[model samples]
Target chain A: MKLETTIQGLCASLKSARAEQKIIGFVPTMGNLHQGHLNLVREARKKCDVVVVSIFVNPIQFGPNEDYDSYPRTLEQDSQLLETVGCDYIFAPSVEQMYGNKPRLTNISVSNITADLCGLQRPGHFDGVAVVVTKLFNIVRPDYAFFGEKDYQQLAVIRQFVRDLNMPIDVVGVPIARAEDGLALSSRNGYLSEENRQIAPMIYKTLKNAEQELLQAKPLDEVLESIKVALTGAGFIVDYVEARSLELQKVETFNQDVVLFVAAKIGATRLIDNLQVKYIS
Target chain B: MKLETTIQGLCASLKSARAEQKIIGFVPTMGNLHQGHLNLVREARKKCDVVVVSIFVNPIQFGPNEDYDSYPRTLEQDSQLLETVGCDYIFAPSVEQMYGNKPRLTNISVSNITADLCGLQRPGHFDGVAVVVTKLFNIVRPDYAFFGEKDYQQLAVIRQFVRDLNMPIDVVGVPIARAEDGLALSSRNGYLSEENRQIAPMIYKTLKNAEQELLQAKPLDEVLESIKVALTGAGFIVDYVEARSLELQKVETFNQDVVLFVAAKIGATRLIDNLQVKYIS
Candidate 1:
């Protein structure tokens, strides 16, 4: 359980693991680990000889108006949770350690995949993710990298870049981890007020209902409108509720595997969740 | 020497080499190998246990109006030259092999440093270079990558991205390979007519004179003007002649390491060259 706070230290640790012919697995996260992140680490532990979990609240990914300054930092609790999950290394680098004094001159942009959904609402978000994740991949040089299906568009974006750039790492998307009430686990959930926390479960429930409606040949636009109405009815300020193909492209109806995506603000905290609906009929 | 035309073939070959703990050195080039490119290979031979040279005339890096279609690709002769230079593998992937039917969705861009000089003249040039070089680095995963200082700005761009991205490979800039008459050897030089070939060496001479003038504390603007006049007098269309800091930023004087860059056209062939001026005073 090594805690590597610098790129040099992380590389040194990884070099040793690589020398021993170990299959390294990487899980990159924005710290404040929840059950969702721990599940990723546990999956890494099951599949790999060494599992490295990075905890950095990437400033680049957040827009100027977004939650960059107030993002959660729970290293003490996050480290404990990761250790309990049998993680081999925790790469928790400071912003200075990662970016230094110079302006970030290098950027990795993935088009098409990043042009819709969360990408449109949060511009430059996935490009920031693309850049940082690339740096992490270069630093770790892992055999496998784990990403949560909870961030469905993010997972798609990563997969797109990995294939287009010909990076030699398998990108595995783990299923979304949800609460007993069906609310998807997110670090941002901590920002929810007690009342909003209770209402957050509706985000997932809306997706489930939308999934059922779509699979039963309901009109895509109608089901989407219902989701917006349901969330807005429950005191959630609907950001976007749309049905997209599994590739995250706009769809008129569910002919193949379609997904229901929802994002909204309950009080000041914004939450996002999506569910895939496979048409059996 | 093995010629690997497919990514799988190259990886399989590299796998056996890595298993034996070989340090790989890479030199990326556009074929029609000249003395400059061969020199790069020879240096790679001297520094690494296994040398892999990639001859990819990357279409992404060339502008629509540029010479991508007409770019000379002498793979047969180039392969022979690489063999002579002790290059262990020539990873010459075809356009189809490198990029399938899909569009190139991933792009790596470097700003600031690429905001001037050749970067200004050719829009999206360094970005194209950035993306292709990143893909090459990912594919080869070399311990060291070599570049010719002849393309000073390109070398600077590569170094910046590799460092900013925290790529493990060390970037080595080999000295510019020159002919007896002082013209920087280039594949583009093949396009020069016999009369233009005689006039081509003037590009190097102009850079040298600019270097001496700047080192002698001459006015930077005056020296730059002289370079343009000298090339224009030789029946060449002077594109730009400017002085920049070694970091490729605009400089007012020769108080530090300065570089004199020149680009011009003779007949239909465009030529570029530069020389470094180390101001000792």
Candidate 2:
């Protein structure tokens, strides 16, 4: 597998791949690869002729008070995991390489969609995500880009961005990979204490139970309240638990494509999870 | 030359071109097919294997009170002009074809650089320009995209967008094209009456005189004042006349790369022009 640390090197490689008529698939991630990231790489490997994975802990995406400095960086282990998953190229640019001497003044803002859920709690988080993802998409010039459904709002925002911008890339959302105990895999899970780790699975469990309750025609507000109560009862600080249309807009009826999204804090670690649920009337 | 009005058709054609390893150069314009627009096409033609021209009078770029309704649509004549210039394709998507049922909610904003000159007069103008140009860049996926320096701040904003986003395409800023009378060519120039047309050249003349006066080492404030006064004296309603760094930053000294920008109203028509200058100590 080829490893590229600079945008120039990645483009040079992609140019050659384009010459040879290769279908490139890109999986962009903040490294410290878990099974979830590997699953995205595996999805790319299944679909495209070449798979390129980018591992950069994007500083801009984290809020100033959030975990920018504390974010994990395990490049060596991540590289080995990617190689095992058959990723063809690993683009691991340094912070300096990604952002030069001056901070970027260009921003891509997706309105409406980014005004809810995680976007509300973490302001400018998705804008930072939007900008860096756009930069990576331009650099990779991939035919297909894979993102995890674990970040449901982010996936929606990216899809909206690509559609609105008329970008050539096809964004595919991979299903959220979970632990055997049902906890959604996340790098931030590293911050969990052993006691908090024992409590994390309950967040996903409440979401799954909420999905079932939704099928029983419980009022969305009641179902949401139940989920929030359940999480809080289990020592999780509830951020929000709501049912939304796939567009991230609040939906009253479960008649159409809707997702149940949950964000809560277990001790100091914040975790998010979502489940797509359908109601048959 | 192929004419595509649909995004799907354009992408299909571009896919074949990519397969054949053609280097596409794109020139996006609001179609009235002036000499200035053709100059951008010519620049693309000189460097690329294929030249694609998109004539979209982007409504979003015009302020609510601006001249969007009166913007010319001369596609047939524009296509004839593009053919004469060896443009390989003309993408003349209708307003409906370009933007579907809903208006775009995604915006690309370049801060600091877009805060001066024309941006001050036309709020949300550069944002609209940035969004549409980004959309065009993605749709065409050209190797090189050309813009005229006639819109100096626009060129600078685009450069910043491309650099900050790390878009794969190289943005080429073609030098401004002017009429024999030295008035900078613009589609809005069509709005001028015969009497206004006769007086329009003075805007350029005042800018030229100011450029010459800058070599005399006068303070920038005095130089700017003189140019504004000259335009106002010539029956023009001056918007602003200022000297700024090439990056569109306000500059106190003309010691480095700087551009003098001018905007004025000739009767009902608003006109803008700029000149790059260097000072030798």
After superposition, which runs of candidate 1 have C-alpha atoms over 4 Å from their true positions?
none
**Best candidate, TM-score-wise?**
1
**Per-residue C-alpha lDDT of model 1 across residues B48-95, encoded as one tens digit per residue:** 999999999998889889999999989999999888889999999998
Worst 10 residues of 1 chain B by lDDT: B209-218
**lDDT per residue as tens, model 1, A141-208:** 99999999999999989998898888989999999999999999999999999999999999888888
Instruction: Report the interface RMSD that candidate 2 achieves against the true structure, in angstroms.
Output: 0.8
Q: Which residue runs does candidate 2 get wrong by more than 4 Å?
A: none
Task: Give me the candidate number with maximum DockQ.
Answer: 2
What 10-residue stretch in candidate 2 chain B is worst by lDDT? B96-105
lDDT (CA) per prediction: 0.90, 0.90
TM-score of each: 0.98, 0.98
Residue B275 error, candidate 1, Å? 0.4
- Clashing residue pairs, candidate 2? none
- CA shift of A91, model 1, Å: 0.6
